[model samples]
Target: MRLIDADKALEKISKMIDYCEKDTSVNGLTALFQVGDAIMDCKTVDAGLVKRGKWKFTGTDKNGDVYQCSNCELKIGLDYETNYCPNCGAKMDLEEPE
Candidate 1:
């Protein structure tokens, strides 16, 4: 949940691929390239679910308080009978805050 611009991340990874192609002196660049590409990969994993309108929720806060999302998909599972947001409405499905 790094909350980065997806297209920008893709663009950066593309540039890195090209840079890796042209540079030969840095043997460690491959690891860097993999890590960069992994960022893009992770960014895409939950995107489709997000686009479909399924929201994941966070059950904790910045102050280290913890909660149990009784009605959340991550909690008691998806049921249409609940009126409250799961995960304490912390917006798990929402993009990470900028």
Candidate 2:
């Protein structure tokens, strides 16, 4: 398992915002804004995930999300870097991305 840098993630988010700014069409801008807003909101909410433990899984779902089983001693959800099962140290399975 590897750690992700918060700064890098934020930088990527900023780049997306910049792209949205350059969008001229309402359709494109609307889509970008919608997605960007969600991303931004999530980033704010999940900012502390970097401090948690993350285990990279070996598979991906149909949505192309990298399967991850977090061990953060909390519930598993999207944007989660921490998931801990109280039963043992053993966590849920994560399929590797193809």
Candidate 3:
């Protein structure tokens, strides 16, 4: 899955439509429909800061001591540690223990 700016894509597609409108040929009609299909497959880019941080061991709770996501402060269980935060899409890592 790729992300793209929908507004920019739409602007380009609008130009294509304008050109196709002025040429009224079979190729122009085909290009117009192709642009429509492209629009249908487009996905807008997510708007926000791209977060990346490591899990920090904060404090203990009822579920035993847990780590907090540095980006979103979400508490995660030791059993649920992963490469990414479930809540904020932040990439997470842990320091090696000696």
Candidate 4:
């Protein structure tokens, strides 16, 4: 699923309702008004669960190359870089110097 700015969408819907009101030929605008009200009553979603982070290369060892997670500083060896951190569940999608 995808997220969108509810307020902006509501504004557009409100504009459409106003336009419908001004134009007598336009019909079936009750649903548009209901959509705006529904948006106002909807709950907001945040990015709290999607913790952003990046993996920094620390060094190499006899075992293999090492990298550290920026968010939790959890260290791991090479070829183990997953999308999310194992320790803190931070998504390793940050664009920075590796």
Candidate 5:
């Protein structure tokens, strides 16, 4: 379970945004936006991880729904389900808990 470097992720996102601003291709811009979103999500997750402690990131809740950032592969224990990866902002594909 590797931890995400929030500073690096944010820096990369900034660069991606700059490139998107100059890019003219619709497809390229769309791709950049996706990447940017993931980075932002990663930043948020990292912050939480740092504030809460390492155990929180790795521990599973009673419900057994683990939180993971697909883009950065940051896994954490979460009590509830979320639509996006807190670490990379990627849309979560995990099945909903019953």
Candidate 6:
């Protein structure tokens, strides 16, 4: 799974929605709008999770090779190996380096 910052994701999704609105093609607009809606929902849920203390916002390296929990600083390498930080039980929602 790919992780991203909630606010950034939301912003990107908004831009996608705007692009979709401007598109004249039915198929492309429909598909992009649907994908944007799904992404917005996921980002909203992630934000809620963070606010509830169930998840922590973290960052990944440039190559998306590493994830370090913001709450505990525990490093995670394998993307599919786990979902939560072992040290703090913080949900892993890692934003890629920009």
- Highest lDDT, which number? 4
- In angstroms, what RMSD does candidate 2 have relative to the true structure? 15.7
Measured against the true structure, the TM-scores of the candidates, in listed sequence, are: 0.31, 0.25, 0.40, 0.57, 0.30, 0.28
lDDT per residue, candidate 3, 62-90, as tens digits? 88879888888888777656889999998
Going through the candidates in the order shown, the clash numbers are 1, 8, 0, 0, 6, 0
For residue 38, model 2's alpha carbon misses the true position, in angstroms, by 12
Candidate 6's residue-wise lDDT over 7-62, tens digit each? 77667767766866787565775766777666756643332344111233255666
Error of 6 at 77 (Å): 40
Q: Write the residue-wise lDDT of candidate 5 on 58-80 in tens digits.
A: 45667676655645677766766
- Model 6 global lDDT (CA atoms, 0 to 1): 0.59
What's the distance in Å from true for residue 79, model 2? 45
lDDT of each: 0.50, 0.51, 0.77, 0.79, 0.60, 0.59
Please state the error at residue 44 of candidate 1 in Å: 15
Better of 2 and 4 by lDDT: 4
Candidate 2 residue-wise lDDT, 9-82, digit = tens: 66766776676678755466576666556455543333332333336544556555443445543333244433
> What is the Å distance of residue 61 in model 4 from its true position?
2.1
- Candidate 3 similarity to native, TM-score: 0.40
Single out the weakest 10-residue window by summed lDDT for candidate 4.
40-49
Question: Candidates ranked by TM-score, best first?
Answer: 4, 3, 1, 5, 6, 2
Off by over 4 Å in 4: 1-26, 44-49
- Can you tell me which runs of candidate 1 are displaced by over 4 Å? 28-98
Worst lDDT run of 10 residues, candidate 6, spans: 47-56
Per residue, candidate 4 scores C-alpha lDDT tens digits across 19-68 of 77798776576656566565765556554567989989999989998999
